[model samples]
Target: MDQHAEATGRTPDDERLVCARCGATADGPRPTWTFSMEDGRRRYFCDSCSREHLRAIEGRLDSSWW
Candidate 1:
């Protein structure tokens, strides 16, 4: 998925969210995904990516720093 696509804050026409870290796709607006606001844009991460980077997330580190 294109990184710029996430910044646009427009959900895909199909309403799926793609992970910023891994390009994984999921039916969005779901509770299982990890959502973050960075650089004033909404970013979503799939469950696997979120679990792998749980500590970095809790530390409030920028995803770019991870």
Candidate 2:
């Protein structure tokens, strides 16, 4: 996906949400994949949920073990 797409006020397929931390497709709104935090904070996670899931990762060790 294009970085400018989000800045241009464009949404994803089927109301998909992109993570603010990482630019990965988040869970769909329908069926409500969103999880609530203990502090009353609502957030979402995506394919980029963990640092170990990166593909062409840089600025780290040769984490091919993941």
Candidate 3:
């Protein structure tokens, strides 16, 4: 297993959640924010990106709309 997997106790595939904007993995040091889409798909965002796009997220706008 890779170092990241070892550190997070999850394999790369098991840590599938990634920031929809920046593509940062959920296993990174920064926290991740998750939102459930209307269609029931879960979207994740890194802490930095989450803070940067807080308004749009709270407005219930999709990232594609930004």
> What is each predicted model's overall lDDT from 0 to 1?
0.79, 0.39, 0.60
Model 3 stretches with alpha carbons more than 4 Å out:
1-12, 28-32
What is the overall TM-score of model 2 with all chains considered together? 0.30
Residues 1-66 of candidate 2: C-alpha lDDT, one tens digit per residue: 454334321254455665433556644443322222322333333444434444423332222233
Error of 2 at 27 (Å): 7.3
**Candidate 3 lDDT tens digits, 1-66:** 454533333356665555656766654434456453534545556778788988988898877776
Alpha-carbon TM-score of each model against the true structure: 0.80, 0.30, 0.61
Better of 1 and 2 by TM-score: 1
Candidate closest to the true structure, highest lDDT: 1
C-alpha root-mean-square deviation, each candidate:
2.2, 9.9, 7.0
Q: Decide which is better by lDDT, 1 or 2.
A: 1
Ranking by lDDT: 1, 3, 2
Residues 1-66, model 1: lDDT tens digits: 555668743355766778888877766465778888998988888889999999999999989999
Show model 1 residue runs off by greater than 4 Å. Answer: 2-4, 8-11
**Number of the candidate with higher lDDT, 2 or 3:** 3
Higher-ranked by lDDT: 1 or 3: 1
- Model 3 C-alpha RMSD vs. true structure (Å) is 7.0
